[model samples]
Target: MIEVKGLSKRFGDIRAVRDVSFSVEKGEIFGFLGPNGVGKTTSIQMMCGLLTPDSGTIMIDGKELNPDSTEVRRKIGFVPQETALYPDLSATENLRFWGGLYGLKGDALNSRVEDVLRLVELTNRADDKIATYSGGMQKRVNLAAGVLHNPSLVFMDEPTAGVDPQGRFAILNIVRELAASGKAIIYTTHYMDEAQKLCDRIAIMDLGEILGMGSFEELRDQVGKGFQIFAKGDFDGPKLAHQLRKEYEGEVLHSGRGLLAVVVADATELGRFVAAMKAQGVNADDLKIKETDLETVFLKLTGRELRD
Candidate 1:
């Protein structure tokens, strides 16, 4: 339903997005995964016609996305990170207002508003003022407002940020329902678990460039076998680091006075690693092992952690 090629944008000397490209099918959830300030939102803005690209092309349903493409824009629904509803307005009022902006009216508009409210599981609180709702509830209504017109493709930019776990769970289900109904979804977030849970394919981006793109497992393979061992103690970092590089088929990811992290191919060698630490006479107050995750992938690709 959507295809982007060589998409790029710049703010003066800074390249906010560079040579980015990807595609999303009618029933697929395409994810833009990265940390903040990596241009995920800027790329989305260019695609949804909120911002013009400095270079490259954005095609939705075969036609180009430009200022004159009102019809193409109509096929998309964008739910931004922040709530766009009026504080004094109830959910029904908020959705009706947004629906009217889409030129929806009469029984058709009313039916759609009700349908989306039910879809987000907010029908019971449909009449509550947005100000009276929790962050999660407001988010659900924000989602309802975005798709009230039944757009063919939806752009959800961190729809679950700052929401409680239950709220996040509900929003995820709503997204699944949207995809099950055959609407293409472009979901952008830094949350690994959410992307892993929802997206069929993910594009990992950093410094305005796409470092990797594939399913979760596929991206994991790109980094080879990775299991991180983090130890915090007084130890000879360079000494142990040297030993790791020479003896193990992995990299000493982080090594310093108080912390040492190593990514090993096989986790079964955990005992020997612990033994080696003891042989070095290190006393670790905190030590932990992490299996390969999106954070690990992000670190391997960008040389920075996800929260960084």
Candidate 2:
């Protein structure tokens, strides 16, 4: 239930976000994905009423974003990219402070604190100081504070940034559980795998612009068949490639060694390519086709490596 239209933000002469627009449906996990410094945080800040955009509108449940409105803040939760938690306070104490800020008190506040702590699986450590918790634990606590108020919409910025693989999985599971509970989530990350697993739809941003937006399959189809076919080292390269191209109308590139890069419209061509290769005395079992995934789509669309 969040909508952004032509959202643009400028810092002096530089624009952090340029006419970027997208929407998040109620109870859906929408991903805001991009590389570093690509306006992800800037856009999120404006949506949370922490920063005002220079141009555009952010509407939440038909109510336009007003930076000073407590009513707006009441309906939204923000777990920032950075840790805004108190290192000295216990997990339960930290949540207590946050819950109180939202006008929660007495039994209502205490129940929320326990509910979110359990949701993040920090109940056993709820009384321990945050400094004793690992980075993942701290991030979980950070997430708990955001949702302690049970806001209808939550914005998570790099929620799993410093966590290990296990922690990342735990955090991802929590996000999924939240969506199942009917919370609309705006999740941001640089990890393609995370986005692939967590998002119902994704908006890929780069250089302050939305380069693409759609379901993962829709975006993957946009890149066509960038798949590759690899075979054993002794197989014929060019002659076999020529026959496969003639049969399937595919582009063949030698992928070094005996591996052949076959680009075609669909995987049905992959079967035909294998059959042709077998007819020419090559072992079909030695052939393997690698489907183009989201990482490949990102590299093609941004023309840059994810680490770069």
Candidate 3:
């Protein structure tokens, strides 16, 4: 229900986002992932009409969207990383206030408040002040406020950030239910496992660009369908890395710290790699094939491990 093309934004001398383009379909959860200061927030702000882009186009259900697309903004929901909630107010009170901002009023606002409190399983303590609630409970109330308008597309930035395990689980289930009901979602988080568990497709961004985008398998294949053998301790890491890079079909890198990684495509290639290492008089106390995961894919794409 949303499409963004060639989107870019700049601040003085720094360009926060550059030529970003992605789409979220109905009933799909699109994971917007990146390390800090990599344009994830800037991009989201433009899409939500909080910031205008310098170039490119944002389309909401086929119509062009802009900062003043008042009607279009009605179809969008934003769940910020920090809660815009009043601690003095109860959950029901907070929802009532925010729902009114979305043009919800009277019976419609009251009914939505009741429905969402139930949907997030917060009806039991809906009357308690938000300050008395746990962090998880507060987050649930924050979520309730965001979806009260029933927007067709939602942008959730680190919704599970800092929440306890139980709270995170509850929020994830709620996200699934929203998607199941045909709402498109743009979810951002530093947690790889959360992205793996919830997102239908993933986008990895770095340095204001999308380094990779696809399903887990598709992105993993970019690093080659392989095993990354990691070794530490005494060894000629740079020499071994150089030889492997020159002769092997996959990637090889020496971290300049005691670590060396060798990526081999399959069993036969792995065997040959092992033999080659032995032939080169390389011996290390630590050596084994590590499981290739989303981090591995990120490492291949960015030449560095993911760090928050």
All candidates: TM-score: 0.93, 0.82, 0.88
Taking all chains together, the TM-score of candidate 2 against the true structure is 0.82
Candidate lDDT scores, in order, read 0.87, 0.85, 0.84
> Tens digit of lDDT per residue, candidate 1, span 117-209?
999888999898999999999999999888999999999999998999999999999999999999999999999989988899999999899
The Cα error of candidate 2 at residue 185, in Å, is: 0.4
Provide the lowest-lDDT 10-residue window in model 1: 241-250
1-308: candidate 2 lDDT, tens digit per residue: 89999999999988999998988987899998888999999999989998988899999988998967789889999999888899999999999999999999999999999999999999999999999999999999999999999999999999999899999999999999999989999999999889988899999998889999999999888767568555555755666676665556666534334545555666566777777776777664366666776665676677554662
> Best candidate, TM-score-wise?
1
Candidate 3 wrongly placed segments (more than 4 Å): 232-237, 243-250, 253-258, 265-288
Using lDDT, rank the candidates from best to worst: 1, 2, 3
User: What TM-score does structure 3 among the candidates reach?
Assistant: 0.88
Q: Model 2, stretches more than 4 Å misplaced?
A: 225-289
Identify the superior model by TM-score, candidate 1 or candidate 3. 1
Question: What value of lDDT does candidate 3 attain over all alpha carbons?
Answer: 0.84
What is every candidate's alpha-carbon RMSD to the true fold?
2.1, 5.4, 3.0
lDDT of 3 by residue, 110-206 (tens): 9999999998999999999999999888888888888999999999988888998989999999999989989999998878778878999999998
Per lDDT, the best of the predicted structures is 1
